[model samples]
Target: MTTDHRTHARVAVVTGGSRGIGRAVCERLAQNGLAVVVNYARDAAAAKETVATITAAGGRAVSVQADVADENAVTALFDRAEQEFGGVDVVVNAAGRLALSPIADLDLEVLDAVLRTNLRGTFVVAQRAARRLRAGGSFVAFSTSVVATRFPAYGAYVASKGAIESITLILARELRGRDITVNTVAPGPTATDLFLDGKGPEQIEQLAKAPPLERLGTPQDIARVVAFLTSSEGHWINGQILRANGGMV
Candidate 1:
C-alpha cells in the first residue's frame, strides 16, 4: 500500500460508503492519501468489498456499520475512527433513503422513514463531526438538486433534503473560529442505484437529456466535487450549498 508521507495521515469517515456515491467518495479520498473509515448501514459484504478495493489499490481503509439515525451508533462510529486512525479530518454524511409519492398519497410511515434516515441522519452525523473533527476538518453532507426541480411524487424526499440545505449554513456559522468547513452538495440526477431505482427507461432517458450536458452524472463526477470541497484548496468555501449539476437547474 502507498503510504501517505505527510506529517500525519488524514483520516475520513464516510457514511454509506459501501455503495454508489459514498463508495466513490471513499475511493477518491483514499487516492488522495486519506485513511478512510467506510460506514455502511446493513451491507457488511459491500463494505468489505469497498475496503478490499482500496487496499488492493494501495490505500488504507476499514469498514464500520452504523445506522445514521442512531445517536449511540454514530458516536461509536466516531470513536472507532479515533481508535483506529488517530483522529478524523473529514466526514461525509452520505447515508440516505428515498421514498417517492405525491404529497396527497404519500404514506406517513414512508415519510417518517425517509426523514429518519436522510434528515435525522444528517443532523446526527453532523453533530458528531462538529464535536470530533480536528481543526481544518470538513463535514460534507448530501442534499438533492430535486429540491430545485420540485418534481412531482418527490415531496417527502425533497422535504428531507431541504432541511439539510437549510441547516448547512447555520451549522457552518456555529463552528466559527474552529477552522472547519461545513457544506452540502446538492447533485442533479445522477446514475446511482438510488436514483435509478423505480425509474423506467423512458424516464431515465428524459432526465439524461434534460441536463445541458445531455448525459447522466456518474458517482465519480459527484465525488470529485466532494473531494475538492474537503481538500485544502476548498477551505475558503464555507457555509454554502454547491450544486454539482450540469446546468440542470
Candidate 2:
C-alpha cells in the first residue's frame, strides 16, 4: 500500500479506476488534492498505471484489487483505504459492466451479469461506504443517459443504471444529517472504450450529434462533474442525479 502522511487531505476510493471514465475520475480527484484509492476488478497493470500517473503528478494514490459485487472484497477495499490514508471521504462507484441487446433478444446470462455488476455492485459498495465514510464524505455512482433515451439494445444496461439512480437518491436521504452527500452521475455518449466498443462510425457519429454540443463527451468532462459533487462547494447538492451529457435529454 502506498501511504501519504498528509493527515488532513481527503481520501477517495474510486472503483473501476484502472481505465476509461474511472481512470479519469481518479486523476481528477487526485489533482484536487485528494488521497485516492484506485480500485480495479482485474487488470493489475492498468491499475498500476493509474496509480503511477497520480504519483507522477505529486499526488498520493494506491491501487487495490477487488470484485465490487463481493461484499467481503468491497469491505477489504474500504479497510485498505482507512488503514493507508486514515479515512475515506469520497467514494466513486464507477465499477460496472455493460451488455447490449434488445429486450427480446437479450440473453438471460448477460442480463444477469450486468445486474450483478452494475446494480448489485453499486449496492455492495454503497452499503460499505455508508457505514465507513467519515463525516463530510460524498458518494458518487454512475448512471447513463440511455435510461431516458430508451435506446434499443440497451435494455439490460439501462435497467441496471436505472436502479443505480433510484438507490442513489434513497441513500442520500438515508444519510440525512451525516453531512455526506450521495449522488449519481448520468453521462451521455462519452468517448471511452466502454462506449466505443461494438459501435461503428455511423452509430458513433449519430450519438455525437444527439448531444447539443455535437460531440462525444470526454472522460475528463465526466470527471469534472464528479469532482464538483465531491467538493465542499457541492455539499449542498445532495440526492440529485446530475446529467453530465451535453443536453441530450
Best by lDDT: 1
| True-structure RMSD, every candidate | 1.5, 2.8
Over the stretch 151-204, how does candidate 2's per-residue lDDT look in tens digits? 989999999999998887799999988889999999999999999999999999
- Using TM-score as the measure, the top candidate is 1
Cα lDDT of all candidates, in order? 0.94, 0.93
| Cα deviation of 154, candidate 2, in Å | 0.4
lDDT of 1 by residue, 29-95 (tens): 9998899999999999999999999999998899999999999999999999999999999999999
Judge candidate 1 at residue 161 and give its lDDT.
Answer: 97
